[model samples]
Target: MTDVRVLIVGGGLAGCTVAKMLEDEGRGGDVLIVDRDPQAPYDRPPLTKAFLGPKDRMVQSPPWAPADVPWLADCAVAVDLLARAVQLASGRVLRAQTLVLAAGSLARDLPGRDNRVLTLRTVSDALRVREIRSGGAGCFLVEGAGPLGMELASTLADDGASVTVVDPASAPMERLLGGALATEVASWAAEAGVRLRLDTKVVHAVPVGDRHAVEAVFSDGEAEAFDCMITAVGSVPAPMMLHGSRGAVGAAVVDDMRRLVDVDGSHFEGVFAVGDLAFHRDADRSLVRSESWTAAKNDGEAVGRQILGLPAAAEAVPYFWTRQFGRMVQVLGAIPLGAEVVPIAVVPKTGGMLYQASIDGSTVGFVGVNAQRLVAMLQMQGGAVAEWVAPEV
Candidate 1:
């Protein structure tokens, strides 16, 4: 059995970031990274954006070299907390002084069996979708109007394919952007030549013929046939591997410190969870999980620092960004459902717009379209919208 001071599961952004930070702090020699994927860690956001383009190529991060951190390309099947060891599919057992779970999440698959339908989550999944799209102009139906779905639809439309986006939400990203921005995005989709089927749900997707096509059945008893179908319904946490004497096989519970909590509400010592699998407890004792890339990176860095007995990193404000319909949308902080939105600036020449969302006269969030500098300045200043001079008409 191989023994290590720290064993990190999952090779995605969170795991890699932690390993890199530890190495930079002169603690790399005692770390081991185990990942199921054979390929080196790569940027994942592009799988639904730039990677869909015909001329784009897969981008991978450089492997660990200076510290030469040990990497085990194997799947961890079971975790024996009592023995402080993990069993891998290859019949290898690894004992660790500390275990970090960054297993991430898996893409939710569409209901029913239809080999023609695809879902994008991994590099291999992106390659397969790109290959199918390169076959020529054909009808593509994308389920879910969230960021991934919309981005994929935009890319497919730009590639000369007929794209249709179906979602149960009133508008694209309604929950995140609220009504005003969602409506604007819907218009953007229309202008980009992508069809929007809002307030609609796809019941199932079944093979329609022998020509690699799928017929998607809707909640309204309407069926639509398309050359290809992709589901971006969302993702769920990956299967948890830990097992304890108290029968806590997959503890989704986590304390504010990001430590896995047992069924009895006690945190396990020497164990930590990060990324999508972590259920972080807020100051109010409410558990919330952040699936954003930035959140995962912050979680890793904070956890690494804590393990090294160093000062905790400053908490990062929630931030997210995406590109669709040739427009870059950036958001910071939470904008409540009924928040008052005030337009701060509009630059027609640059096609930029900025808005500040406030509740009870205190700014809570900022949304910008192609106005990155203004958004960054507001974010740094921290509270209430700053007065700005409007550009001369």
Candidate 2:
């Protein structure tokens, strides 16, 4: 094996997995992971659930193991890609043969949303949300109807707080889960005393005394208020540091087929990127977007294998899961919004629905709750979301 000294930027799931894979492959000397956060890499998904809940469900892991390997626990200010040197905030420059850009993405905030609006991206942010939530019964306004918003609403609802999830879609998770599962999720929320307002848009957020309220001057001039607010709308690539990198956007740009940076594929020899920061393209050069932990793990491992001169693994499946109101929601594939959706299954009285997406007779993605095993089985059977199967209730 070539003595390839690897400098990994970003300390989240992507960086951690890459470092672990390298060590597991007995290539410790070829790896060094750097992260801006002082604390070790921790899971971010649970922040909206167990960590923010009353019980103890926090899971922790060191960014990198073994005292011999170095983990630069600080922000990387810049990267001298040509010279293969990474400049840290502490004025330290580290050299490496190859660099993996996995800085990940940031919480996409709503327009006019203030910093007072809670976001659950990092541990610190999660702690703040938990503190505010545990203080007392308060109203929360979640700006998006995505998985994070639903999970946060459920956690807050469990804590005896009213959560109002706002989204542009006509129904909660309508775009991804389709009408059947979205209705099931909405029913679950209603049973839990959580309010779901579809087709609503927020005009702006204003402070009322010590409390903050959002003015939802919708298309019809309607308004609403809440004591606290949290934005789980979405996430965008956090590639602000790669401004100087050639053709690099807010995230590092990479060609999926070539597995190299967008710098002509010849500028930085042997350098590759994975995870959220890596702007990747598929066979048609169509951007493949994913920011889940599983995607990061798969991407990191693929890059590692490629570095080891192994055949590239199959295109990584983008798998992710969410928990809301004690229900386990897992998605294995990407359900293209506006695509044809069909319901697959619905349990007896639980109102759980399984929906799949199909594009030109090819199953692409699926979304379901309490049916992880079923979904796994379907995927194993070469199922691509061909159609949405209604609940056979």
Candidate 3:
């Protein structure tokens, strides 16, 4: 069995962040990363936004991850937590002093669809979508109106493709933007010529004779045909490799130090889990399960420091953003379900708005649509803001 100081299971943003940090601290030589995708550890947000454009070049290698660092392009099949060992599908065994689980997530796709029903997860998936579009799949059906679906639909619509977004939810991004803000977003989407079919879901799907186009039947008893259908329903934690380990792996329990908790309620010594799959405890002592890219990056930093026995840094506010239909929507902090959203100000002609998400009169979060400057200012102020008044014409 080969031995190392640290063994990382996934090579996504979280995995790369941990390695980059350790490398910065001169511990890079002791780390080894095993992942299924050789082109992984790259930024994924770009895969949906500004990706399908003709002028856009796929970012093959992000500068954040160094190629000099040691890594293996192989899938991890099992983990032995008691011995801090990992078994790869290639029949190789690696034991480390510390184990980092950053296996990311698995995209959920519709069951009754053919190979044309794509889900955007990796750069390859995005490339396939692009290829099909180039091959004349002009009409696109994006199932699910979450951030992924909305972003993909926007991207396709921007590329001159007829796009229809269907979801069972009442409004777009209602989970994060709440009622008013989400409705505003939906309005913008509609104005941009995107077809938003809310309160609707695909109940049946079948491929056309060509196998590229799909005929889908919605819950509203309406049937439509599209050249392409993409599912952005959502993803679940992919800690399947750790399932073979000693304890419960998918539990939403991790210490503030980013250490993975064992089934016995004690954190596995030097074992950490981060990114999409793992649940983390924030500074407020509340357990938060986030699929945010920012959270994964933050987890990498915290886990790195903890490994080095350094003092943990101050917890950062969870931040996420989506650029769709030439507008940027950003979320800072947490937006609880059914929270109240209050508009702070609106730009005179640009249709920009800054909103505050409140729970019981306290600003729990901020939602900014095309208000980058104002949002940056409020973020710099540590979420405290003066009364914002829109400038008059």
Model 2, which residues run further than 4 Å from truth? 1-4, 54-56, 62-68, 178-180, 211-220, 243-250, 263-267, 282-288, 346-353, 360-362, 382-393
RMSD for each of the candidates? 3.0, 4.0, 3.0
**Residue 195 displacement (Å), model 2:** 1.3
Give the CA lDDT, 0 to 100, for residue 263 in model 2.
51
lDDT tens readout by residue for model 3, 1-393: 999889988888888888988898888898898888877767888889856753245566776675667989998777776678888889999898999988888888666766868888877888889889988888999998889999998888888899999999888876666654666778778877899999989998878867568899999999999998999988877645554245545563677677777766677777888888687666776766788888888988888888787898877776888888889998887786788878777866678888887777776788888888777776665423223232322
Worst 10 residues of 1 by lDDT: 384-393
TM-score of each prediction: 0.91, 0.85, 0.92
TM-score pick, better of 2 and 3? 3
Q: Estimate every model's Cα lDDT from 0 to 1.
A: 0.78, 0.69, 0.80
The TM-score obtained by model 2 is 0.85
Candidate 3 global TM-score: 0.92
Model 2 lDDT tens row, 20-133? 777777887678778877765677777777756543445465444333446778777776566566677877887778777777777887678777777778777777777776
RMSD of 2: 4.0
lDDT of 1: 0.78
